[model samples]
Target chain A: MDVWNILEYCAWALAVLFGGHMLIDLARVDSTYDNDLLTSSREGEIELTQELHKL
Target chain B: MTLSSAEPTVQAQASTQGGERLQLLRVLGPGHVWALGVGIVLVGEYMGWNFAVGKGGMIAGLVACWLAGLLYTCVAMIDSEVTSTVAAAGGQYAQAKHIVGPLMAFNVGLFLVMAYTMLEAANAITIGFLLDTVAGLQGHSGLHQPPFIVLTVVFLAWLNYRGVLATLTFNLVITAIAFLAIILLFVSVQLGASHVPLDFSAISTDPLPYGWLGILAALHFGLWYYLGIEGTCQAAEEVRSPARSLPYGTMAGIMTLLIAATLTWYVCSGLIPWEYLGQAGTPLFDAARVTGSTPLMVLLFIGTIFSTLASANGCINDASRAWFSMGRDRYLPSWFGAVHPKYRTPYRSIVFLVPIALIFALGAPLDQVVTFSILSGLLGYTFMTFNMVMFRRKWPLGTIKRGYVHPFHPFPAILLLLICAATYFAVFLGYGSQLIAMMCFYILASLWFHFWRYRFVRRGDQFTMPWPRPQGC
Candidate 1:
């Protein structure tokens, strides 16, 4: 094979490897949580007060 | 001032902080962070790198991208360290404040905000152009209407104001679709019976069309491929286990970008003559059209739109966060720091940024806007890398609980600093006017800091680092 052919295949191989790694890394992440932190206005306000005091 | 009146000011400050706290929800995971990182620059891999090909042909363009990728790799490694260790909302700006000081942080914050906002505006205009072309709205009187740009920014800002989860979910889906589209394009090129074998020998002798100088000239376009991957670190405050997620997300994001960029350059250049492909605004779409398949062209067009949406959406998310961080630090007005009571997102900052981005989207040419963004971005990178060197001196290894550390201790930081310096100079030479504009912006930020903020702003103590701790027992 010529240089172009070699480089093309190498690019494809690298893409597969990297894509797989990214997927696996993403798969390991857990996103399950309650929306209370986002939705509860009172709780959010209280948390903000505490955070400001800490600062 | 009397103590009673001072009490009201303190109460107002507390209320402001409370509202700001309600804005950013801490729920993003490694996946969302990775998606944001990839989404922010996916459009560049799809379209902008072709300019590098125009400057230096295929080989030289590839070389420039390789150098840029190396620089980004070093940047990602060191940035992961700082982002994870600091675990703040401002990303590089926060790192600058902690490692250097607030004055430097102000400059870096403004540069970052400008770079991301400009990038967002560029994507908005590109989307309008794509829609115009796809719908055959060209050659019409209202080809580039400001209303369309305004509507697009408003829609995206509304999504941002809704919540971080909604924004990131949209980013994840669009980025995934875009990635698949690129892979599909690569597959079609490989398996199509009518595939034209690329004539590498045709341009072998004169790959450096403008000679070695073309390589340096191509640096800014080359940077387009992997420019905003560091943005994932900006979402550090919202991430769970930032010490772990920030490094993993950033590394994964860079690796993905590097691979996508290589495949893009290899496939698109091979499918068509580099000279023709280099000048086309939508090179990949044109390459698909050359295949003589209507469906392939339509698919790639849709892919381009998805990539554009992902970029603009990610930019809004990042830019608003940077603005909010500055507001929280009193670097900008406290009004910029306000969050939506119900949605828990930085609605005020998002609303404030939309018109600024829309104006640029409607007014500026693509090349100039892009150059301005890259110039400001490189300035921020230079500052962050220098700050990394100082951070290592202050913290050292084993001194603190670091999730990840760039091995070889300072070499990577030093190398990244040198690369940033060289690229900054190249950019300054290439776009002198933009550099001047950036310098003026920096000066304006300095004046704001010294004249107004330094005198009136009461900074919190969260950012104060305690060094040289008293000896145990």
Candidate 2:
């Protein structure tokens, strides 16, 4: 319950959390490989960026 | 000059999206966008005055939040129109480049990256700060250490590289957690408190607190919390009906933020005394503890973690895309344009942002980084307001279909322009040191890119409409 012990525990816990999330992201990269969003929200920005490239 | 009457050419251009695939799900609507805004506002409003100001502070803060939200609404409405027209991934930088020119656009991109970088750094430090409080780790500034902070930065960077859907899904889940935290805190306070002192009239105030100056200063701090409204524009192409969706989503987000923020502020403030909440290092955590519910405290801690992670992810996703968009135009190094061979996302740009963010998170003071974030966000908004005015005069109404025409014609637009001008000047007076230095640094960097790297290229007429025109001058 002391401050020092508490700090040590959190530092370790966050490090683990950060590491786990990175691995999960890397694993999921393969599925999102297409040149679009995983889920669409709006088409304007995506479409415009595409149009600019064509120009 | 008007565009060529050839509609076919424009269609052809729309089909090819900068040599990238058009793969995504059109799942989000105005409702979803509103939820995201609610999520951001709820979290943002919780901070700032909660710990520092207290009950009287909360009463004053809610009024302050609403006034600031109104200013944000004006800025976002203009942004929604621009975003609807473009259907592009990057937000401010893309808008600036199309309207202002490459040189100015480059400045927007540089400042945007720095601004979001500050956001990322703030989230990390805030998370660290939160953890220290919950775990009773008072002196732990582990985030200040470069190696530890770099790990956090790299983690989010990789997540961004994974692409947009993963980020959005994460956003949804984290939002749930954030809301749950609020619910738990509210319940704990009511059930556990033998004496409940409730103030129903807390949110509504006459003439508003601090008057115009109070509102202005609140807007300044308000800018800090509601800063990322435009980030949604980065995902415009992914949304189904951006013309309808952009404005609707933005409005929804703002309303949700308002409601969530009001509830969180009032309930949490009632649970604990203002003096304690204001000065307490981890005010939310302290509030949970005071409710005498260990389970609720644990849930809040987990929820805060989720909130921080989601925020960092959202910030990085938008910031890196700005870099990628600029690179695609060959404004910055082409390396930024490199898409992951597999992920098909702006992997390189996303990766590059991590180190820069880490440098700031690990190296700078927390308050200094936060001030830089506000400066960058305001500077970008100032450019956006100007762009809205110029877009109206330069382009014919018939040419661009999706943009929101300023109601009451140019008068309202001009009023907004003046407001932006005054606010930008006031920001200089308020956070003058951090604001000036960060703006100067980016301005110089932009000039270096323009004169040195892109000197030989003939500058295109930036104000020209995207549609083609006749050659006879």
For each candidate, report what fraction of the true interface contacts it reproduces.
Answer: 0.02, 0.11
Q: Please provide TM-scores computed only on chain A for all of the candidate models, following their numbering.
A: 0.52, 0.51
TM-score of model 2's chain A:
0.51
Q: Score the docking of each candidate (DockQ).
A: 0.03, 0.13
What would the per-residue lDDT of candidate 1 be over residues B186-212, giving only the tens digit for each residue? 787778723456456636766777887
- Show the lowest summed lDDT stretch of 10 residues, model 2 chain B: B1-10
Model 2 Cα shift for residue B34 (angstroms): 5.1
Instruction: Per model, state how many residue pairs clash.
Output: 1, 27
- Native contact share for candidate 2: 0.11
> Model 2: runs farther than 4 Å from truth?
A1-55, B1-42, B49-60, B137-148, B183-196, B199-215, B403-430, B456-473
- Candidate of highest lDDT: 1
Candidate 1: the clashing residue pairs are B23-B344
Q: Give the best candidate by DockQ.
A: 2
